[model samples]
Each structure stands twice: as structure tokens, then as C-alpha cells.
Target: MTTAVAPPLLEDTQLGPKAGGFYRYQNIWTGLGFGIFLGFVAWLVSHATVQGSNWGTDMVVTCTMVAWVVGFNIGMGTFNAPIHWILGHDQTHEDELYAAGVGQGSSRYLKFCTDHKVVGTQYLVLVMVLFGVGGTLAMMIRTQLITPHSSFLDPQTYNAIVTIHGMVMIIATIIMVSGPFANFIMPIMIGAKDMAFPRLNAMSFWVVVSAVPCLLATFFLGGVNAGWTTYAPLSVQAPAAMDAFAMTIITFVVSVTVAGVNTIVTVVTMRAKGMTMGRLPIFTWGTVVGGALGLYAMPAFLAVMTMMITDRATGTSFFVPEVGGSQWLYENIFWIMGHPEVYVILLPPVAAVLEIASTFARKPVFGYKVAIAGFVAIAALSIMVWAHHMFTTGWAPNLAAPFMLTTELISIPTGIIFLCTIGTLWKGSIWTRLPMWFVYLFVWNFIIGGVTGIYLSDVPADQFFHGDMFVTAHFHYTLLGGAMIGATAAVCYWFPKVSGRMLNERVGKVAFWMIAIGIQVTYFGQFWEGFQGMARRIAYYNPHYETANQMSTAGAYLLMAGWLVFLYMMINGWRHGKIAPANPWHAKTLEWKVPTPVPLENFLVDPVVTSDPYTYGEGVPDGQEVPESAPAPEPELVPAGSAPGDQIDAGGAS
Candidate 1:
């Protein structure tokens, strides 16, 4: 194996302003500038070739967008380390460049810093922006739906808003937990200093960042009128704005694929010496499984997009009916990846909730093995169930029965997840930390989501609910309730570790109840509208559904209010919240074992495991684990394979 050279210590001597050379390249504006220059150049070249028609402009726009992607990456210096590394060149200074200059202050957040924590923070900020925009788009949708007529936006404008909202939110959901928590916390949990490939880490983060513009670019380009799932024939006929969605997804998938490989390698190879597979923390397990799903699943979406792009730019009849193209081909590839995608969104939060549940419940996670089995089963069964999504299309009617069976069987594993969580809550003096409250909410909301999912798994019930608001509610329950709720829990739980500040508990609770209530109110109202036979993605609705639509819109605004409060809580808490010591919750995970504003190299040396990290209750012994409600022991550098660290590792013994 070619062992990657460890970069220099994360905290390096800062260069003075007088310093020249690579110091000039540390900012993101450089990337933006390069992107614009290249994009304009590409546009000119296209215009020079094509004349008179909009086709010339279309080609120019397409070429410019492609050039900008390259330029943005170039500006970020993403290509620097790779070219040097591949050619056996020295890049020792490249390490210092990422150390983020003299003060290493807030500017690091804007620059391409290689630190996992830095990259993770970047991803967090990115999602916050994306979600905020997506939320605003959603409120518009709800507003227009009120009173069953065109009001806030015209029908075409409404379609564009809906399409943009749907697509951005899907990307947001995919990255919400996985990008932030996994990037920041996983290596820490596995006892590694950084990800297996730090450069790849920065690239993964910035690539996603670079793609954001293209996603939003659809708004001005005649709009992406198709739903988030552009599908075939429809996507083929979509306006030029659809190209932006395709590029956004395609770029995001590349990021996912890159990050996936890096995460898997980190876990498999970088665990603290004795932290065996069985000893791995639940969140680490979640990261690995989620990463694996992304590694395998996202490429399929990329393939679908690539072909779709080709169909547009080259006049290839890939999806055109008259020229021997097949629409089913696109749907098959998309859903094949799509079904596993929910699990990809879901697993990290599931792992996170599982972790929080055990700590706050004052118990070891009940059925750790069963939860692991559940993860395994969910991943194994997820691929087979994609066709359950296709039942409504009637593309392959005969296959529906087998797909339905696999879909229902998935419930057995999911049921195990519920079993483990509920079992942990049983008979324990549950300490409801602000974060843990959301974990419990995740359980409740997910139950509704899951049971409804089972209902939809069957062909007959799906026939009833397929095209309506019921479908929307079901997924919102799962995706929002599962991923978003859990991400909030994780942020609350780990805020201290990330920001070195304690989150305001009362504030979190208020935001939580408001958002949770808003979610239930909004989706359940939509559910009733669905029962009244309301179809989604339309500007106008039937007069019979006015009350429910109005109610749903009101609830939607409420949800938006809650999110604003939540955003306020996060920002205010970070800037002025109380300073927290290392382990505020007294959790026993390896991350909590570290000190505040964690150093570049996570630990002085890697941690080794002697026993499971989640040892609850006394085994009639004095010092077996980091006890509940005990003040955290002060952290210090311990040598690898040495005394104090060994003792610390074994201290969590059962």
C-alpha cells in the first residue's frame, strides 16, 4: 500500500504579510474570478462558431457553465496537490497554505482549508444557506396554493419555484447530516487525526460549493419546470434551465462519490488500534454504511444525468420517443439510485439518534447488534425496493409484486431500529437534554413515516395515495422528520464540541417544539387534502380543498417561523453562548473525550479501544467509564501504545 505522507502539524507558523509565493492564492474570490474568465472565454468561442439563432446562445451558455466549473476548481487550488502528488513532486508548503494564514481566524471558513473541522464547518454553512433558500421557495408554494388560484406567482413561475425548491432541498437533504457530521465527527470517532485523504476532503467540499450557483442558475434561464425527478421524456423536453439542475446534481454526485471513498478508507484503516469493528461507535458505523451507499448509489444518478445532458447538447434521441429512445431507461437508473438515497439521507441521523438515545436514556443502546443488523438489512433491501416507486408508472406491472415484497420486508429491519430506540427508553431515568428531545421526536415522527411507507409499499394503497399530497406528507415525515430533526439533535448535542460554546437549552426547546409542531400541522393538513384527492405540483387546487390548503399554508408559514428561530438560536449560541467544558453531556464517545476547539491533529496520538465505548451502569466497580453527570476528566496528550492512553482506552471496559 502506498502510505500517504502525513501533512505537517495542523497548527503551523503563520507567514507575515511580507511573505509572497503561494500566500496570494488562499481566497475563494480567486476561484470565482477564474471561473468567470474561463466561462466568458468559452461563451465567446461558442458564439464565434454558431450564428443568428438561440442555439448559439444555448451552446455559449452551456460551454461557459462547463468552463466555470473548471475555473472554480482551479481557483480553489483543488488541482494543485493532485498534480504534484501524482508526479512525485514535493507539496510540503501546500500543507501550510491550508493552515489559513496569520491569525487563522474566520477567514479560514472562506478559504480552502484542508482541516476536516474546517471543511465540515464550510459544509454546515453551505447547507444553512441552501436550506434557507429552499424554505423560502416552499413558503411561496404554500402561499400560492391558498384559495385555489394564481396569486403570488403565475402557473409557469409556480412550476419553476416548485422545481427549484424540490431539487435544492433534495441536494440539501442528501448533504445535511452526511456532509457536516460525517466529515467533522467520523474521523474523530474512529480515532484518526484527519480523513484518509485530506486533499480529497477539501475537493469534495468545494466541488459541492462550486455547483450551488449552477443549481440556482435555473431561475433566470427559463426555469426548471419539471419536478425534482425530471424523469425521461419530460426532462428531454424541459427548458434550458433543466440543464442547470442536471449540472448541479451531476457535480454534487461527484462530491458524494469522492467523499464516500475517503470516509470508507478512514474508518477501515484509521481506527484506534484496538477499536475493532464490534467496538466501533454507532455513529461511525452509520457513516460507513451511509458512505458506502453514496459510493455505490450516486454514480448511477451521475450516469443518468450525463446521458440526459448528451441528449440535449448533441440532439441524440436518448429519451425522444420517435427516434427509438426509451424513457423507461432513465427512470430505471434514477430510481435504482433513488431508493437507496433515502437510506443515505436517513442512516447518519439514525445513528446519531441512536447515540443520543443511549447517552440521554442512561442506558447502553438496547440491541446494538440488532441496530447494526437493521442498518445492514436496510442497505441490502434498499436496492430491491426501487421498483416500488415505479408501480405508479406501470412501466413494468408484473414486477410490482416482487418489489412490494422487498419493500415490506424492509420494514422488518426498520422495526428493529424502532425496537432498539424504544427499548433503550424503557425503564431508564431519561435525561432530556435539548438535543435528546429532538431524538425522541425523530422516533415519533419516523414511526408515522415508516408505517405510512409500509402502506405505500403495497400496490393497491399506493394507487390511492400515489399522486397526491399524501405522498408528500409521507416523505416529509421520513426525510424531514428523520434527517432534518436528527440533524438538529446532532447540532445541539455537538455544538459545544464544534464551537466551544454551550447551546442555550431553553431556546433550543422552544425552537424544537415550534418546528416539530409546525411540521406535524403542515404535513398532516396536507394529508387530509390528499384524502380529498388533491394532486401535488399544481398552481391551482379544487375549491373543495380550500380549508385544508389554507390550513396547510398557515402551518407552512409556522414551520418557516420555527426555522428562523432555530437559525437564530444557532448563530446567537455560537457567538455568545456560554463557554462549555469538554464533555457537557458526559457522553462516552471518543469525540467527547477530546478538548474544546479540537486541534488540527485530533488527538496527540490515535485512541485504542479496550472495550465498547457505550458502557452504561456500574459493574460494581469504581472507575470503568466516563460516568454520567461526572465532571469530564481533563484531556492531555498521551503517547500511542503507551501507559496513560492504554489505561484511558480500557477505562470504558464493560
Candidate 2:
């Protein structure tokens, strides 16, 4: 058999500004202008061609959004490389460097730069914007619930706010950890220079950028009133805005699929010499698993969304019951992606927490292999348990038992992960840093979330809890409380490395307490209302439930205020916080070994992993594995000006 030859690696060259060509004219503003122009042209054509028909408006919107995606990519220089290839031309070394954003300074963040760190930073900003939009909608929702008969928003308006809010937050949380930390931190942790596919990394981010406008455009197009799930019958009946929502999901699936493949491939093939699978960091494992699960789950979302748009635009009967389509089919396909998505949002942050716990507690992670097993089991069982979400639908009564059993069984591995966290923190002298504080918050909040989830997982108990404020409170505990909390900790933990500055610990702590207390007050109020038999998704409620609703609303305002403060802290810290040195936390991970404001290739010399990263405490040799119960006297701090992996032949920047 003939052997395949690999392409030669490019020699390192100092990157400079663009060499004056077509790319100089391309950026996000250019992309926006092109997209808008194309969308308007498509709208004019579709309106001129079709009028006074059931699918007329939907066809216009769908065609317009498609045109926008294509036009935006064209204007962003996304098609330049491929077009060059088709004409027997290739990007020179300088073109590649320019695309990687070497000397462009701040403007690179707005362009289609391929640097993984730049993409990660872009995802961070995107997450904030999404949360800002979703949080505003949340405030509107809580405002409406403040009084029993409040007409703060009309029914259709309230439903639209809830629909967009659910979807925006879901998308934001799914990418919160994986988008930022997975891209910025994971490559360094694995000793890779960059992702296995860097151009795809940049494309993944810019594609999501194109999709966000489509989601926001939904409101102007009369809103998607079918909720975030966009369940059948209602979705099929929704106005043209539903077309925009479907386009957003379809576009987002491309981003997730591309990003997932890059993450998995980077970890699998691009890992540094000697960085064997067993020696890989916990966060690396967490990110890879999350990426893989997202790949497994997103296809269903893509399929359902495609079918949804077809039904709306082409007069198909895929989800239209009166036209012989089945609502049960929609629910099945939706939840097939839905339940695993919960883990996709959860795994990265949970793994980050484990990494943080090991660092701050001055100990090795307890049961490292077991934690990996827990992630695997959670992903494996998540797919089998999706039908539990349909217990109340009455579509398949017989499958409920099997679904319920799988749901509860999945909790076993979840408990194991929790136990590992506790075991790691048990006897070590814990450093109560800002990141560690969030870890404590995660433990407390996730316990409540897990226990309440069990109550809802039971078939008999779910009869009361499903579709009430109880389900809302339970999932908020899981997603917002658990996953979001973990993401916050990761931001705090890695902020110094990413930004070259220390976070404002004082203000961060204040925001942390307010948010923690607000979560308790808000969800606890909802929990009480659910127990009192109050239904969900209603603008009007009985007068008797006003007190609880008021409490929930008041607590929601607290959450909003806390997040505003957190946002301010982040911006101010990034702009004005004290300059940091390499390895401020003195952690052993390869990322910490790198400089603050890490360089273009990550390392001047490639990293060769000699041992596991979490070798803390005294008397433990550098490469020796620490067992779950292993302990020693409190480890001495690394002297100022030195870090754990400083001995490696690597370069650093101040």
C-alpha cells in the first residue's frame, strides 16, 4: 500500500498587517451591509413573486434569511480561500498569518480571525450579549407575573418574550463554557499549538454570528409564540417569524457541529508529545465529552428545524396534526436532542469546577478515571432517558416506566461526580479564592437541583410537577444554578490567564452573594407556587398566588441587579485591573505554565507532558499519581517569580 504524505509545517514568521488585498475590505460591518442588502433583495423578489397565500410570508422570510447567511459569508472573506483554490491559487504564508490575526490589534476581534483565543474571546462577548437579551426578556416575564391580573404585556407578547428568552439562554449556556474555555484553555491544557482545524474554528464562531441576527429578527417578524421547543401544531401555525427561528437553529447547528469536530480532533490528534490519554487534564476530558455529545445531539435539532421550516414554507404536513402529521413525532425528535443538550451545557463547567477544586484545595483530583466514567455514563444514559420528558404527553404510556428507570439510573453516575468533588475538598487546606467560592455555590445549588429533579423524574410525582412552575424552578436549578454557576467559576478561574489582569475580587464577591441569594429566593418562591398547584406560562393567575408571585418577581430583580454588577466587574477588570504575571494562581496545568496574554503559537517550544497536572502537596514526586485518599501536610506556595511547569522549555510573555 502506498503511504500518504503529510503537508509540511510552516516555519514561524513574525505576523504583520494584511498585505493589501481583497481581505483589507472585509470585516463585520462589511458583512452586515452585504447581508442586509441581499436580504432586502430577496424580500423584494419573494414578495413580488408570491402574494395572498398561506406560505407567502414564510417563504419570503426563509429566503431572506438564507440570502443573509450566504451574503454575510461572502462579505466576510469566508469564500476567498476556496475561490482561490478553485482557480489554482493558494493563500501565501502572509495571508494565513493575517487571517490568524497577528498584528491587527483590537480590530481582529471583529473580523473573521482564526486564532482560537480570539474566537474564544468572541464567544465570551457573544454569550454576554445573548444573556443581556435573554435577561431583559426575563425581567419582562417576571414583571408580568408581579400581579395576578397584570397586563404589563399582552398574551402574545408575553409568550414571544418567553419563547425567545428560553431559546437565547439555552444557546448561550450551551456555549458558555465550551465556547470560551474549551477554545482558549483546552488547547493549551493539552499542549497543542491550536485546534486541529483553526480555520473551521473561526468559521464556527462567525457562522453563529450570522445566526444571532436571525433570532433577534424574529420579534420584528411577529414573534415565535410556540415557545423555545417550537412544539408542533403551534409552530406550524406560528407567523412568518417562525421561519426566522428555524433559520437560526439550522445555522447554529453548523456552528456546533464544526466546533465539536475541531475540539475532539484537537484533543485526539494534536496533543503534545507524552500527553497521553491518561495524562490529559480533567478539563480536557470534560471539553471533549461535551463537544462529542453536542455533535451527537445537534443533528436531531437540525432535522426537526428543517422539517419545521418545510412545513411552514412548503405547505408540508410534517407537524400539522389536522393534515395527518403527529405532534408526538415532533416531541420525540425535539427531546431526543433536548435531554443530551442538558449534559452538553453541564459537563464543561462541572469539569472546570473539578479542575478548580483540585487546584485550590491543594490536592489531586479524587477518582480521576471515575470522573471520566461519570461523564461517559451521563452522555450514554442521556439519550436513553429523553422519553421521560414525554410522560405527560400520553403518546406512549408503556414506555414511561423504562424512561423513568433510565432517568433515575443516570443519577448514579451524577452522584459519583459529586462525591469526587467532596472527596477532593475534604481534608486539604482549601484556598478560599473567588473561583473556589463559586465551586461551593455549585455544590449547594446542584444538590438542590439533583434532588428536585428526582422528584420530577418519578412518573407519579411528575403528574403534578410537569408543566408547572415546579418544572421551571427545577430546571433553573439545573441549568442556571448548576451549569451557569460552574461557568462563572471558570471565568473567574481563567480570567487572569485570558485577559492578562487580575479580576476585581472585591466586587466579584459582592455580585456572587447577591446572585446566590437571589437564585434561592426566586426559585424557592416558584417552588412554593408549584406546591400550591399554580400553573405555568399564564399571564393571568388566581389572586391567591399573588404573594408568591411577588416574591419570585422581587427575587428576579435581585438576580438582574447582581448580573449587572457582575457585568460591570468583568468590563472594568478587563480594562483596568492590575496587570498579572504568568501563573498567578501557581497551578500546575500547562495553561498556567504559559504566559499571561499567551503568544501566537502558544509555546515557542512544543510541550512534552512528563506527569499528570494535579500533583499538589508535599512528599509527592512530580510524576507520581495521587490516590483518592492520599494526603500530606499543607503544600508550601511556589515562591514568587516561579511556577510549577517553569522548568519546561517554553517561552513566556509578561
Candidate 3:
């Protein structure tokens, strides 16, 4: 197997001077920049609380804070400083460069780095930590739900646990799917060195991280019990915890906005020559569309969260029933962002699954153009379908007809993605590899998830299932099936690429089966329990619901076991598994073309484009095996007025 020659750094005369200036001022500016911004926000909040007449001031301060943060990162050279130092420039010191740890934790991580890979890993870690915390809350809720009318926990505590669980899970879903895989894999797939704006990438992650403490503070400060949605009069009536929740959500929206901008810029501008829109990988296309949705949807969420914060702290009656505040405004704004937010969390992972399936099946992604179109359709359709979630919440009946139509229309594009997956696997030499297994599972799970979604979207059917266990079951199917499964599959598929070691197949398979079965056991019961009239978030549910709840609890054990085993396998693999080849999966992607333990700047020389990634079967040159080595063919170099050093012909034809 041949190793890929790394790509050379592209010189940018226009950017070089600006980059140097920013690097020179980086250390001093980054610390003070964030500090000043935080101080300003604190002051504004304090002022608003005390004086009470300056409603416009809060909006102005928010805009200014966001702008300053974005500009400060750009001014400090967070993104390109590492690249500058690594490319043999001496404007920056070795110590400064080393402190940044190449591209892994650039000083940019303290600010913003435009490297999607770094942002992705940041999201992965962030989401995993939150997932653990969320799961703890879930355990508490489960413990309460285990027995009928038992006082193991008080009603208030139960409410807090349920609320926290829902909020954390929502945040986890948003951050998990797009952050790691999209950040890490998208550039690699499209053959770029880094995201279009590495600084913005870093900013996105830090924005998300900064929000976490605020979220946790909610629990300590009499947590909001209205669940993550924080609906209506109950939300306004909640304690100081509601303030914290609102602030946390606002922070999250900013993070999503930053991420959205970065993703859009990177996908639009950073693709390799010949990697046109039609040629872009399925996952990359998914991220592009998903990021767009996030960009458009997040601003509305930010507005609503700000309005909520005002309602809680400043007594501005956006949702206050008595003071010209319409509760329906909250519902309108929340679902506007909320529904598309679901697709934002989901589509990228679905895209990742498509890429995984194509890679392991040793085939071109079936209907590549069709898949891209599907993603675009899904993005557009996602916005119009938001009211479907609010059908029974007294939205206009006229609204329901349009929303119902749009919601159901989304299935058309969603089905296209499904068709692509099935076609990719049809009559193909499928490798029963760990990644592929997860891909197969994703398809099955997503199918069920999609079908279940139909029932929820139909207004008539949703009227019955609106606030019951059925809603929970539907979401679990959608999230676990579509998002979590796809994310896990991506982890398995790319773990070797990231860590340069092979995970244990046996343990991986064990984890996969347990998770698959466990999910079925856990959520399927919710459907039956919901059908029989069980409400969610009640500490003490009906005794008639006991059997299904017990079964779900039992399934949770299996689920936990599967995750534990998977974690152990990954940790052990990193420590002692066999060193991996550069292209372990024998896939056709630019990332696999690079050496293992990817270099500081990613490539040593710029790669010249040749062919599309998944050009399998007859598309590949006759009698030429898909090289289980590098994505690029060996280049014939024109001697630089001298013979090449120790050129060894590895007995292969060009």
C-alpha cells in the first residue's frame, strides 16, 4: 500500500500580512476580549433589572457582544496562526505555536478556529459529557416512574429531573450530530485542508461550551419545570431557573448560528477542484443543507429566547398574558426554530450513514444527485412544517392544512434518501464491517422513525397522541433511529481515521446488537403504553402503565451495557489495537489519502484532482483494483533540475 504525498500550503499574499498582525496581538487580545464582553453583558443585565426602562438597550448590547466576539477572534488570528507557524514562518514564536498544539487545540479553541475537524471533536466531547448528565437525569426520572405514587422523590425534584433531561437531550441532539462528524469529515470528504472560517468554527464550539454552566446553574437555582420547550404561562411563572434556561438557550442559538455560518462558508468555498456540487459526497451535501437550516432557524430561536429572558427578568410581557403578551407568540417562535431544529440534528447524520454505507459496500453512492436534491428539499420543507408540532395547541385550523401538507411533503425527500441507501446496497459486495452494520441499522431505524413521524404529522392522529407516551416514543424513534444511530455509526467509521487504530470487531458487534435490540425493547413499549393513556413527565403514572414502563426500564440496562462495552472497546483500541493502514477501509476519499496521525497542516503537497470518490465497478479503470492504500494515484514528478531521491518503484502501474 502506498502512502499519499501531502499537499503543499497555498500561499496567500493578501492574507499573509493581516494574519501576522493578528498573531502578534493574539495572546493579549483574546483574554481581554472575552472578559470585556462578559462584563458588558453582566452590566447590561444588571442595569435592565435596576432601571427598567431601556428595553432597546438589551437588544443593542446583545448585538454588540456577538459582533465583538466574532471580530475579536478574527483580529487575534485564531484560525490561521497555527498554519502560519507550521509552514516555516518565524513571525510567531515556537512556544506560542506549541502552546496551541498544532491544529488540535489552537489558541483558537480559546476563541474561534475555522478548522471543522477541531470544531467537530469539540462538539463530540461536549455532547458526550452532556449526554452523560442528561442520562443521569433520565435515570432519576426512571426511578420515580418505576413505582406508582411512591415518594422516593418529591414532585418538585421529579419535575426538575424531567426538565433537565429534556433540555440536555435537545442540546445534545443539536450539538452531537453536526459538530463532530460534520466538522471532521466534511472537509476530508470534499478534499479541503480546513473549514472556510476556522476561527468561526472554534467560536461556535466555545459558544456552546459557555452555555453549559448556565444550563447546570438552572438546576441549582430552582430549575424550570416546564420542560425544554418552556411553554406559555408556566414558563413565565417559573423561578430564577427560567432566567438561566433562557440565557442558556440564547447562548446555544448563538453557537448554532456560528456553526451554521462556518458550515455554509466551508462547503461553498473549500471543495477541491472537480468536487463540484453534483460530485460532493452525500454527507457533505447534507451538512451544507443542515447548516443552512440551522442558520435560518437559529435567529428565530435567539429572538424568542431573548424575549423569554425579558419576560422572566425584565418583566417585558412577550408571553405574559396580562400585559399585551401573547402566549401564542412563544409557541409560534419556538416551533418555528424547534421543528427545523429536529431536521438540523437529523439530516447530517443521515448523510453520514449514506457515506458509510457507500464506503463499506465498495460502491458508488447510488443516485448521488438525487441524494443531494433530497437534502435540499428536506431543508426547504423543514421550515414550513413547524406548526405540525403545535396542531393540538390551538393553532388555527387553516394553519393545520398547510402545515399538514408541508409535513407530509417532507416524506418525499426523506424517502429519496432512503431509496439511495437501499440502492447503494443492492447487488453490492457488502462488507459486514462494524461501520456498515451501524449503517444498516440506521436505515431500518430511520424507516421506522419516518413512518412513525407520519402519524404525528397527521393532525387527526396527533390529537390523540399529542401529550402522551406516544409522542415520547415517536421522538425516541426519530432521534435514536436517525440521529444517535447515525452518529455512532460515524464514530465507528471514522475512529480509525482519527486515532490510527482498529477497534475490536467482536466487541463492536456486541455493542451494536445490544443497542439495536435494547432500543426496540425500550421505545416499543412506550407506543403501547401511550396508546393506553399514559402521560409523560409524571412522577407517579397510572398502575395500568406499569408493565410497559418496567419493560422499558429493563431495556435501559441493556442499552447502558451496550454503550459501556462500546466505550471500553474504543478506549482499549486506542491503547493496544494493531496500528492501522492509511486506508483501512479501502474507501475512495481524500481523507484516507492522507497518512495516519494526520500531520500538523494536513498535507505536504496539494493534491491534483482526478475522479469522483465512489466511482466503483465499471466506472473504475478495467483490471485496476480499488487501491486499499491511498485515494490518489502516484504522481509522476517532473524533476526540479535534479533526479528524485531514492525513488522506489513499488511494482504498480499508474
Candidate 4:
């Protein structure tokens, strides 16, 4: 008698055709075209009506940029559901599936696709594009600073590059891990079908896309020379570009709020039946905390930017000191959001690295609850420490003591997180992969960043370093060395599941070493310059500092080339790398159990969790021998565009 074998669940299935009617025709190109058309119309009308008025070019620029966002949304069918509700013809279920990109293939990526995976993919592309722009700008700044009195760019142009690069990198890093992994992998990790609010997920991404043009337009409008901080008095007197900068910030705030809500709701409400809070992956916890912190922090940014707009557009005194407003007031509100937002950029990637460390070390996450408590403590303390940025301002010398105390105190929770990472790696069987290489790099760099930060947190030491290249080096170490490194590890760890192919490890290692060495050389040189009392944000420097500047520039070029190599590897891997198995690392997380090229609804059967997600190493906690069954026979690889043979397994594998 022959025993029948059931078809494997880990196989791709083709989806049906699109069903959203006319909305299916609208995509990114159509949105761009419509946006340009509306912007031109607004420019013409505003130029005639408001150009020579008291508001002048600021009003005209603001009007044009706002129109572009509105038109883009309209053309992208962002208002379709609301419009349908008004017309008494709400979308059918079929339309909802089509809007989710069912069977739309590559075109779905360009459209206002509501599929969380599609949105995640879109975010990944956007992050890369932003990095490319910002890195190019960094190269320009480094080239200009390669020697004292270099004339590669005028002072105004150099300042513009600095402003744009800072904002762009900040924006990119904020969303880097949270954007792709949180939206794509987090849902599956929790054993959920999709995010609770899929349409809002799509909206969060597209809104940010709309803001990019406004930021870029600043260059043509005579540039925002007020730095990324856009301090008052300087920002108040800047050219029309300041208006565009304000619009970008306002738009970004909206995106952050929406994304924050979506992340919270999805994790809180959508986990599988038995996937309790304790069972959820560390990365999921990280994403949720980061999202929650953003909700608390971003509104402050919104308020400050809005007030700045009013100060410029309506001649309000919100930030104008001559009219009863204070520059100290501006600094206070900006840093309120500014400091917490650092954790917003930070927590997600750090969480991701812990997840990676656990997986590659073949061990459960050590002190999981303690790590969660550490994340919470850091978030709580982050908000109270903002005034530390204003320590040198002397707006409140009496308050400085408290702010410094809080700043130093935050490092305790941060240290707990570090201990958890080291504990997880202690005496474990480590599988050193591309991801783990970055993990090791993170430990090395973050120690330097953390140690330097302590000096800055002390008011006496901060007084000497406040405006110097030391402050610049310290931040780059934290943001670039720490957070960005963690994000790179996450991308490598999750690349297979996202792309259905393995990353090119050989090329990736080459890229990794280059970046590792480059970061040290680059930042160490800046640290040397700062120790020599070199001031930051200067186009020209003393001849004595030229050698340090050249060293930093040389290292910057290596960093740029390394990133380019890594980018190429990702592109090549996505197109033609070896096909990845469903559980390439034999990871225990729910996301790994799903098929590579995850299906429309992620799983055919909802996973019912039985234990904590990380059950790595051998045997039970009580030293009991776990029952072992003979391994299932290897399944043949199904060719592209074909379904596997159907056979019965009534109670499906989770």
C-alpha cells in the first residue's frame, strides 16, 4: 500500500487580476504629473496675487508646495474611499483586494497599494534613495572641507548642502528599520494576517513621498542656510526656502503620527490567539515602543514648525523675540521633540539587533523582560532630558543641574540593554554571518559613542564642546555608528524573507569591512579636530586643522564607496541570488515559518503559539529530553509560475 504525502505549504500561488476599476490606473507617475500641473497653476496664481504682497515669495512658495501635496493625493486616489462614501457607492470587497495589490505585480509598488508588504517594499526603496541623496551631499561637504579655503562650493552652497544632508539623513535613519522591517516582518512575527490599518500604512508612506519635493525645492529658492535645526532669528530672516522647510516638517509630522497609531493598533490587537505579550518578539516590542515614543515626541515638532510658519507668513510673534516671543522658547520646544526622536530613531534598530544576536548566537534572548523594562525606562527618561541640549544656552542655569543629572541617569537603562546583548552572546554557538558582522561592529562603535556622550551630558564638559566638531563627531557616532549599524544588520537578517533570495555574502563582507574601517577613520579624525578646538559649520578652517579635515574626507570617500558596494549587492541579490529556504537560519519566529515570497494574506492557517518565540538550543529548561521525530523528506523546488500538487493535511501546519 502506498502512503500519500501532502503538498508543502511553503509554495507560491498566483493571484487573480486587479478589480478596483478606474483607481487601478492611478499610480506614482500620474500623481507626479498631477502634482506638477497643480503646482504650476498655484505658482502662476500666487505669483500674480501674492508675489508682490506683504507676504511676498514666502506665501507664493507655501501655496505652490501645499497644492502639490493635495494634487498628488487626489491623483493617487488617496481620497477615493471618502469620495465613494460621499457618492453613496462604497467600494466592494473585490475593490479592497485590488487596492491591496492582488495580482497587480510590480505595478502595485508604484500605486497607492494598501498591502503592508508593498508599503514596506516602497519604504525600503525610499530609504535608499534618501541615503543616496544625503550621501552625495556629504561627499560635497567633505570635498569642500578637504583643505583649508577650498573653493569647490561657495559658503552659501556649502551651508545648503549641510542643511539638506542633515535633514535628509535624519529623515532616512528615522524610518530606515521601522519602515521596512516593522511594516513587513512585524505583522508576521506576531502571527497576524496583516497590519490592523492597511490603508493607513500606505498613506503613511505616500505622505512622506509627497514631502520630498518640498525639501528638494529649497535649493532653487536660495537654500535654507539656517542649518537643520533652523534656529530662530537666522531662520526668521532666511529666504523663501525656509517656507518649503516648514512645509516639509509639517508634512513629516503628519506621517509620523499616522504611522505611530497604525503600529500601536496592529501590535496591540492583531497577534495570534496564543501569542501573548510575553511571547512577542523583541523586535515587535521595539517597533511598538518606537512608535509610541514618536506619538509623544512628534507633536512638539509640529507645533514649532507651525509657529515658525506663522512667524514668517502671518508676521506672528510666535518665535520673533522683538514681539514678545523668545528664541529660548523656540529651542525648548524643538529639543522637546528632538531628544525623544533620537530614541525613536534608535530603539527600533537596537531591538532589531537584539533579535539578530539571539538568532545568530543560537540562543534565546537573555533577560528578555529586563530588556523590555530597559526600553521603557529609556523612553520615559528620553523626554525629561531635552533641556540638556540647551545647557550651554544658559536660559536657566538653575535648571541645568537637573537636566545634567537626568542626562547622565539615562545611561543606566542604556547600559542594561548593552548587558542584555552581551549576555545573549555569552557562551553560545555563534553562526557568524553578514548580520553578526554588523552586530560586532555595533558593540565597538556604540561604546565609543556612549563614552563620549557622558562627557557631553556633563555641563562643565559640554561648555567646551558645545559648538565644536566634537559635538558633531559624538552625534555621528550615535546615529551613524550605533543606530545605522543596527539597521544594516536588520536588513541582512531579514533580506531573505523580504526578497525570496539570499544576500551575496562575499561582496557583503567586503562592503562591511570597508564601512567598519571607514567609520573609525572618519569620526576619529573629527574627534581629533574637535580636541584641537575646531568649530563646526564653517566653510573655511585654519591651516592647522587641514590635515584632520583631509583625513576625515579620505575616510568619507571609503564610507561612500562601501555603501555603494552594499547597495549593488542588495540589487543583485534581489534579482538573481540563490533562492532562500523558508527558514534559512532555522529561526523559531513565526515570520520564518511563512513561505518566502509570502502569500496575499501571509498564511493559509493562523498560527497558534505554544511557547515563547525563541526556543533555541537543545532540550527543555527542566533537562528533559525532547521527543525527536525523523526529519520530513526534502520537498522538490516548484518552478516559477506553477502551483504545487494538492494533497490533504486537514489540520494545516502552523
lDDT tens digits by residue: candidate 3, 1-654: 357543343221123223434443555256356545654665566556555454443343333344444444344454455566588665443333332234323454443434455567667768788988887787677667777777889987788778888889989988776888777777776666777766567767766665676678677767778887889779878766776677678878877887888887777767655455545567887888888999989989889988886776566888987988899899999989998989898888888888888888887788877787788899899888888878998868888999999999999999998888998899889999998888888887888888888998889998898988988888888887678889888888888877789999999999999989888887887888889989877888889999988888777777777877888898888889779888898877777877776654455554544455676664544121223335564455332224321232211112
Worst 10 residues of 1 by lDDT: 622-631
Model 2 bad stretches (over 4 Å): 1-21, 618-654
- What do the candidate models score in CA lDDT, each in turn? 0.81, 0.87, 0.73, 0.86
Each prediction's RMSD to truth: 5.3, 7.7, 7.9, 7.2
Candidate 3 TM-score to native? 0.83
Q: Write the per-residue lDDT of candidate 2 for residues 1-654, one digit (tens) a residue.
A: 223332222324554554525677789999999999999999899988887877999999999999999789888877777788798878887887788876678898999888889989999999989999999999999999999999889998888889999999998999999999999999998877899888889888888889999999999999899889898989888988999999999999999999999999888877766566777789998999999999999999999999999999998988888898989999999999999999999999999999999999988888887898899999999989998889999988999899999999999999988988998898988999999999999999999999999999999999999889999998999898999999999999999998999889999999999999999999999998898889878888998889999999999999999999899999999999999888888788888877678887776555556677877875555542212221233233223223333343221111
lDDT of 4 by residue, 43-112 (tens): 8998998756776788888889899988888788887887888999888877888888876678889999
TM-score of each: 0.92, 0.93, 0.83, 0.92
Model 4 residue 183 lDDT score: 93
TM-score of 1: 0.92
Error of 4 at 587 (Å): 0.9
Clashing pairs in 4: none
Scored against the true structure, residue 306 in model 1 reaches a CA lDDT of 84
Candidates 1 and 2, the one with greater lDDT: 2
Please report, as a residue range, the 10-residue window in candidate 2 with the lowest summed lDDT: 624-633
Give the C-alpha lDDT of model 4: 0.86
